[model samples]
Target: MTHLSGGPALPQERRLVTAVPGPKSLELLARKNAAVAAGVGVTLPVFVTRAGGGVLEDVDGNSLIDFGSGIAVASVGNSAEAVVRRATEQLEAFTHTCFMVTPYEGYVEVAERLAELTPGDHPKKSALFNSGAEAVENAVKIARAHTRRTAVVVFDHGYHGRTNLTMALTAKNMPYKQGFGPFAPEVYRVPLAYPFRWKGDAQACAAEAAEAAIDQITKQIGAENVAAVIIEPIAGEGGFIEPAKGFLPRIAEFAKANGIVFVADEIQTGFCRTGQWFACEDEGIVPDLITTAKGIAGGLPLAAVTGRAEIMDAAHSGGLGGTYGGNPVACAAALGSIETMKELDLPARARRIEEIMKPRLAALMDKYDVIGEVRGRGAMIAVELVASGTRDGAKEPDAATAAAVAKACHAAGLVVLTCGTYGNVLRFLPPLVIGEDLLNEGLDIIESAFAGR
Candidate 1:
């Protein structure tokens, strides 16, 4: 089936013509290793020639069922009709006039739409940027400007971004923060309501974790000294950990009471990926500021810091923009992305994905001891792998097994990803437009991998 783009559709099936990194791809990988920096990483080295719907065609004639969605950046498909049309028209009109130098209507329209579509009904404003990290840094800047405080609070196992300050804000050490230190100061981390890992009853962990976090903030870092409390409604790179229910509301309340800006890092969970415009809406938690990217502009680079008008305007007039902050093409793509989302009812599609995925994953838990737990919301689903599935005790994380399963799936022409603080969670993020047949085929590959078939 053609996507709304009505573009040349790639076959939405897993077709393995040869081994995964087929000869052509291996040659490309060799060239890449020589040309690319070692610091940058690649998940699957299969050189993609074209992609559409739910499949990506590698140069070696392999059709892989895409579950990563280019790390959730292509949720409306790689070429949604609206996104292509709007961006093409804008590209033809002008590639770059520098929005700051000669402002365009596209930028203004995107900002206006962000205000209308984001969580709260309060008067909101937005500043666009080139990437998620930029949006996050700007959010912190705006929060500090508004609150007149130095300390910024984040949570454990939360992944924000890769910029210097974001690296300090991130909790992971190996790839994200290792050797990147003497980092930015005044960034503090408290406990997340991580239900699966909590020592106490998972249900009770919500209220307790919130209290513990609040206590730490009050005792260690005075509330008056804090500028913002930033968190992900559903922690993304840190294994899609959905904080226990009621946890977010408490933190938001504490931030509100303390005159601190509450920022929701929705880079991964925004758009319709989590069955809603924003994951913060799940519990009626309205953040003071929200940082968004990933699915914001179909597949283009675009991010935004959207928040209450007063908080956003706190930054100096010239403090917020960059030369390429809101490129006309990217802004137009964002408008199309939002349009596709609304017209296709992609949020409902994400919910339907959850309805199909969770049960299949949970059934696997019964069959595979390594599957410790299946958790997440909507299309952003994951299964945590553990060495032991004891009836009553902590499960040992099995990152090796997770990696092996992912490799096996890759060989079978399915693209999947693994994440977590321990790196033992296998996460799936198929495009919202993926057909049910392809989705089932991808899941079948996963099940077969587990069965060693």
Candidate 2:
């Protein structure tokens, strides 16, 4: 086994050559414009040549620090040796056999690992998919089949996926759902406990919000008609907002009492992103179903829905699978990724990242008038930008300011990503393997950007 410590050395510091989207990357962008769909949002025009640990080398020959992690997909770091070797070896043997038809050992092994790693000591079962959206959609399907209900409840600022069903489940409406819906029905939205915005005690706010949601469901759709209450423990794209302290526990209690399946969407927060195996583990609340993707296979397209055995068994044998659901190569990559996560103690690494980031971010909050909030769990952190001193800091998000800051950071040879309904929050998902000095350097650049602004 290739140890995580044995990977190629990361660059000591960021270095930029040509402008961010240099000549070669500009040429590629031109080609991409002609060949690819315009709906895709490209943050930086620079094209990647290679990536390892926490740095990305562009085709332009610039070595840039990666704070985006391909939107939290590279938690195990880009091109991890174990993942690469396992994927290559699996590729040499066989690529696909359609696990539902001709099963493979890798597929079964991945499922077994998920069942063990996911939060809960109870009997568990898992099914694989190709993306987070598929995992979430299947969780709903299983919940509905088990509960015999039609309504699914998701919280405000929650992000599930882009599928029709998930679009309805998603909270934001503009980019994800604009012109794309006519969405699937039976989805309900409830308020989430965002302490930074809410005007009450944390526990009280959670209890009130959850009780209100439960009442609304019972009044409007009836609890008997609600199949599941799906949520992201720490909201990801909807501003990386961590739920209020008692919020998750309150929601779990509601789900337990109401017989509604609780689904924890850990796609962006899982695989040790939040210093825990799963974010829900922090509250010690075990959901009936869990959806995961992103870092699961260390950049390969693999997603999973793990849950109690009875709920998973509710779906008929042939009713729950895809042709490429558990592709052999992806499964091999997942096995390697899981092994890497355990052997390297990535969860401990995530805590180290938190230790490094928290104080710096808190300092930014104190210095920058535009920084309304600095929040996250572990490495899945974000800073929400709001215009200074408007309506008790409830000012609308300033996308222009955010764009400028992001561009400035990129010019300084650091890659950062901006996300939020209003495009005003900058999220950081640096690879857990990033060296402390490099991580501090990236944070320093961000501080400089805020200072200059």
Candidate 3:
């Protein structure tokens, strides 16, 4: 009844002594509202005191089952022994010699490991960064440098980042994109092979989407002008929509044939979150460049743009580095995170998570008319909620119901997250080290929330 994946488990169960956002948390919230910026948002305002091994304890002494994994940044658990040890060692020695100014081994080692673990054996190289958006922007820069083209292509319902260029790349409107206009130019949005929303079967959907995308690139953007075709191997933040089978391969082939760089924005799906070292491996689709962050360094801020040596080196001598890019501490944590992943075979653990969650979610679909579909891969699972009306047509998105379910779970002692362009998808991104008891308890809370709603 114990898990040793993370350092010293903290009684992996839900315990609610006070209300969800007890007195201490409310006190912090009031201070935060006065001190913090209005644009910043929080999913659950419970001030966390400590966390590890599938449980997060708030100041109010409420231990909630962590189903979000800090938005999938804690794949190896929050305080994996290896991560803590390595990071602590690095912190003690030196925290900030910034690799750009004073080069260090940890950053070089991280790049080396990225080359070894990422998809493809094409003499890959990497440049580390401080965040996912920075990695993504650098990827586009590298692609543009290599291809000497100005146009970048992205897909619908995709969430890239919050930077100016990334905001242009993203497809959402309200929170991420709205009021942030005049985005980077020459960025074209294409159709994604969303199986559930497609008009036909899976294969047909893939064919249609691929054809449409190719047509758009050919006529509108012109392949000759396109520097890169970037996409999420398994789209994240866009409802965990797995690209229909055959969709990614066709896009890769088209990019290759047209001398365009194919970039996989695996910030959310990389680092064994999707049952593979990278989600691109699921269909044998090797991207020309891959952007990664999130789970790269346990819970630290680290990211990388890894790709073929030629493409990565295309950037000028000093073109691709930030002052804080690849800090020694973050790099050390990343090395430890990768070591822990390999030692524990976290990819297999993610597969086991899929095995446990998919069936339960599928069963819910049969019982709940609001659950239009359950989709995703490995531990990155989600259920799309819809307003039920007819059986043969499109289901109306029920954002209100999704909000209620998430709020209800929060009221109880479970941490869950909702996503999707329509905001009707409940995504479950549990830490790979979560125990069965806690996992089941989180599911029970979700089921009860739906029932009560």
| TM-scores, one per candidate | 0.98, 0.97, 0.99
User: Clashes in model 1: which pairs?
Assistant: 5-81
Q: Name the weakest run of 10 consecutive residues (lDDT summed) in model 3.
A: 1-10
lDDT of 2 at 223: 80
Residue-wise lDDT of candidate 2 within 196-246, one digit each (tens)?
A: 667665557776777777778779888888999999999999889887787
Number of colliding residue pairs in each model:
1, 0, 0
Name the regions of candidate 3 deviating beyond 4 angstroms: 390-392
User: Native-vs-model 1 lDDT?
Assistant: 0.92
How does candidate 3 fare on TM-score?
Answer: 0.99
Task: Determine which window of 10 residues in candidate 1 has minimal summed lDDT.
Answer: 1-10
The Cα local distance difference test for each model comes to: 0.92, 0.88, 0.91
Q: Write the per-residue lDDT of candidate 3 for residues 31-83, one digit (tens) a residue.
A: 99999998999999999988888999999999998999999999998899899
Candidate 3 residue 102 C-alpha distance from true site, Å: 1.3
